[model samples]
Target: MDINIERLKSTLMELSKFGYREDDKGIYRPGFSEADFAARKWLMSIAEQEGFITRMDGVGNVIIEYHAEDVAPDTPAVMIGSHLDSVPAGGMFDGTLGVIAGLECIRTLKAQNIKLAKPIWVIGTSEEEGRFGGMIGAQALTGKLTPHQILTSHDPDGIMLSDAMRSQGLEPMEALSARLNPNLIDSFFELHIEQGPVLDQTGVQIGVVEGISGVFKWIVKLIGKADHAGTAPMEMRSDAFMGLADFAYQINRIIAEDGTDTTRITVGKAELKPGFAHTIAGEVDFTIVARDMDETVMENLAASCRKALSAIARKHKLMFEYEQVSWLTPMKCTPSIVEFIAQQAQKLKLNYQVMPSGAGHDSQFFTDITDTGLIFIPSINGISHAPDEWSHWHDVQAGTELLYQCVLTKAVNKN
Candidate 1:
């Protein structure tokens, strides 16, 4: 049975109201905020009303399940979902699509009076946008969270993760108890809007993601002598901005020498000390975020960046320093699961591609614990985490259909 696209659209429209800002028309459900919790409760409320088993985990993940009467109580479940929380002003489809799509899958099965060999669970994960430097919900569920991380994590506003949980009447340490027994889950599936332009630009209707790229972040500093802009001779000045500029220019060269087609380097943030147009920048502080599918390539890219900055600093007669902030190793989807998804796509006669996701998702955490598959629908113009991000409704229908097929094949004893 195919998912009801109209029903899916209606549920998604209802969900968009929780954190919708009329001024900018963006969703504002950042992790652990009132809007975020409200959205979670709403999912639970609606699922319970519909006679589905539902609960919220300690870390605020919303779990909605459908268990056929014939299925044994202890049977492993097929879990499918994406994050519930969104980036500030994020689009409607980014994370919620997977959760709602899974919900629709359950609705379709029930509507068709289908019995299952396994139960199905749809989860809305928490803090996946990484407000506290981690995918808290998925990590907790996968037993990847630690007490130290729970205590130390904080938002950009300096609100501790513990405090955030406390404000919502949840004990911080309870997050550690949220881990799922790996045996209880048969596999995990996630359907998400490609927050990038790849699928859309290539005219592909479906993306069978092979893996999520690894990432590294560095905070770099360049120090030089400050002087009046007019008095400092152009040839003799130790200009920190010059050093930073030179490094920026070498990024392409570094990628060409040490990176592959999937490598990405971005200078997302930067600041010039003693800010004034009339003063030479004595110090430049910036961040370097690099991503690649392979750990070895990531290492080479990191080394290339360090070497380039050092040479640029020496040429400008400046001192350079950098701190490695964080590193996440690449996660590959289970090979069998990836191939299974591709086979399903071919069955549907859809235009599909095997691709790599440049962005992170909750599915990555499930890779080590269970067979995991991530599917992508295109974002219009590849825009996401913004007010204007969108995916066509038809594409959404196609994706949910594929998800339903996969879940059906895995969870049912017979059609």
Candidate 2:
């Protein structure tokens, strides 16, 4: 079955209007914003028009179910979905494309009058961007996030996540019930734009993701005594800023020795206390983000960071503290499902390759409970989370078709 490109484009264009930005290149709707609410309403309306039953879970995940009358109720449902939330000033096609593409896949199946033993569900998972550190709404559905986490998380404006959910008519406490009984879902699939230049650079139209990378985030703090910058001798001063500088330098050295093309460590955010040009810095705080496809490598890098901190503290006569902010284990896509997707790509005569995802996705969370797979279409220049990000309409259409093929195959084969 082939997706209707015209309809798919029209749907994307319509969705774009909700968070429309004249100066920015793509949409700008953050989670739980008024614009986000409007987009969800629009999606629900579309799902209803397609004769699908629409429901939103407690954490604001939208599920549109297409029932097969001839199928047995006990049969596992084939699920296809992605998140709807966008990063701050993100492009239009990042998370939204996967979701709309999933819906389009079902639309194609319905147009062809295809009947299957298992029902199909297209989902729009919430907050995959971690705007509030809640990923894909999967945390709630998978028991990875607690009500306390939701109640405690706040956006930039200090609007608590619980309040945001309440504003959208969702009960935060009830979000725990959103967890899917592990037996209900048979297999999960997500179609996404590559958000990187890999496929576009290689001229591949599709990507069958082998696995998603693990992520480790830390806040490293260096504490030292504050003193007069001019009066203090350079040799006698215990400068926190200097200590942090040396720490960052050592991190670079470690990365140089152990880092590969896929390994990455970033000190993205930093701060120095006692806002004064002449005052000796008393404390320095910085964040570290480390990612790798292999969990062992990730763990080793974390250990290296601790060693670096200890050595730096001993040299600088400063106290060091390393606080772990977050850690997500790597998840590999199911081999059978990945092979099935590759087979469909070949059958369609589409150019494709197997690859690993450098970024996290909602699919990773689903892997804890169900067999899951991911597909990626090219993102022009491999740019995402920015307005300049662009993916050709043809690529989106190709991805949607591949998604349909995979879903259909899984539904019929029950593997």
Candidate 3:
């Protein structure tokens, strides 16, 4: 059990150094940002330094490989890792822990002089933070990406993904053309922070993920007349802000009453037209996001959103329109893989729980290519995507060990 817990912590800390931001209070390696490319370079340079053969696809995934003597290059390898990029002001461990732990798995396995029948590859996938609404690197590897998806995608800041990839020395079209055959990977494994209170409150050291939630997002605009704030009577004015406000007030009730307990609704952004001190707001713009673990429930939640907001707009005498931004169905991990993970936890004698992921992850994308499983460590106070985000080093070590042993055993069909 020479897993080197301190070594894992040090590697995580070192990764944190690349994407620090003073104003944001968390790491800001938004996809294709300068800091993200720096992190990418660091991953490649470090992999080479560690004596692992390094390579990249057109979408800028950094894969470090360990080839067993009898394993052919074309043989299906066991894939392990998560993404390297982060949301704006995101926590240090959100998508990073898996990659670091995968590296450690490779390190420990090589140190033990263990050889397998198949190769092992640890990847730091690029652009998984929804900056472009897709996990670019992982999808490219899984053959789930299309050239149109990349060429047409843009971040919130209006940066085209094509331009971003080119800036980092990758050709978007050619990189997509380099997609690996799905049959080449036996399975994919990822270890991540729980990012919720379940494991922390229950004192569970490991979480075997059941499935990931489906997400749907929309941009809504409420339109109304702008009038003089001092002269226009409140009763006579058709205020768009009031329309947006009314929806915000009733959203919780809508989901709770009309949808299931697992359904989640978020009004993540709001903007008032002509934001001024004394003028009546003429229009409102906002973003709506909904999530649920079941496809029908997810669709029902979407219908509920439209029902709730449209009624609010009618009552407020405001024109309303919403555009669907994205819709992704829930992804279930292979049951065999989940059971296999549970067996590993049992063998290790670690307290564990089988649970669903409220947040989407790269593992959801991997389900397209091969069996996928996720391991989660607890987040302190269930906090993530902020500078204060943390997982106890002990919990981190336990999750990593589970991942290490799982890969070493399962990659070779020893399961």
Candidate 4:
């Protein structure tokens, strides 16, 4: 049940160097980029060396299966993995740690000569960051995204996902065929950094995730007339930027009024057309990201946002449009697996807490078909998706040890 801390650290450090960035102060491996492709290749090489059968799906999900020679092929398998892609200038350990820990678990099981009733699959799902607004890789494997969807999605720079896939030597037309059959997988687990201060602040070494929050994303555009700042009177001008600013302020107020700690609203990206120092902006666009553990709360928040937009548009006399980008309902971990994780944590005498994740992860998608669970270690100061994000190596070891125990217990008990 003990993880080899030194080995885990060494593996993490080695992978950290693969997509390293000099200008950004850390790694910048965006989904489906060259750096991401290189990282996948490296992972496959490692899996091959570990005597695991490896293959990549059309959408570029890498599956490495570790088999017990005595086990029958018809037996359902246990899967442990996380994504390899990171947000621009993201932390080293967020997605990478889970994947490396999964690999390390397999290595440990092999080295210790442990036998199981089922095979183990260590997967490296692509595009969990959704940098292109489509979790194309995991979505493909889970039948959540189709080949046409992948072919049609374009980056901000106008490069199509299909082109990106072809550039990486993958066939885009076969993406739908890559969907992982629901029956093929019995259970899935992901190990991740908490990416929040709760665990570290509370002196907890591990977190057993109960659920992942739902997400509703939208782009709000305000249209007005552009005029010379000096010639336009403040009362006569329909300023798009001004209207947008007011709308953002009201959105915050709405979330505050709701008074739920889990209800969160953020305006992460914004832009103004004809951006200039001397002109009143003609058009403004901003993104809205709202999340909460409760689906009803999420729906209420979305309705409130729509109503706010309508009121703001009328007040400003500006044309308004709100387009839904995506929405995912919250997913709860399987209770039995959650209980098993809790049991294993207690057996290890590890300091742990049960909590809900504020961020979206691949486990949300996996929950659609099979039992899924998530484990978390701490991120220093709740910092993630940036160069300074970090977690202690000891915390990583503790989480991986718990993850290994949880999987072993579950795999053996499967009828």
In the range 83-162, model 4's lDDT, one tens digit per residue, is 99888778789788999999888888888888788888888888777666645666777888855567666654457888
Best by TM-score: 3
Point out the worst 10-residue segment of candidate 3 by lDDT. 149-158
**Global lDDT of model 3:** 0.85
2 or 3, greater by TM-score: 3
Better of 2 and 3 by lDDT: 3
Candidate 1 lDDT score at position 366: 96
Q: Give per-residue lDDT, candidate 3, residue 233.
A: 92
Write model 3 residue lDDT over 243-288, tens digit each, in one string. Answer: 9888888887877776676678888778888888688889888888
Residue pair clashes in candidate 3: 58-175
RMSD of 1: 3.0
Per-prediction RMSD in angstroms?
Answer: 3.0, 3.2, 2.1, 2.1
Compose the digit string of candidate 2's lDDT tens values, residues 1-415. Answer: 5679999999987887877788766677788777887898889998898788899888888898876788777777889888888876788888889889888888877888877768898888887775565373877767788756776776534577888888888888888878887788889999998888999999999999999988877767899888998899998877898887887778667777766567878886678888589999988887788888888889889988898888888887899997675677888998888898999999999999999999888888888888899999999999988888889988988899889888888777655
Model 1 Cα shift for residue 113 (angstroms): 2.8
Q: In terms of lDDT, which candidate is stronger, 2 or 4? A: 4
With a 3 Å backbone cut-off (N, CA, C), the pairs that clash in candidate 1 are none
Candidate 1: deviation at residue 177, Å? 1.1
CA lDDT of each candidate? 0.90, 0.83, 0.85, 0.84
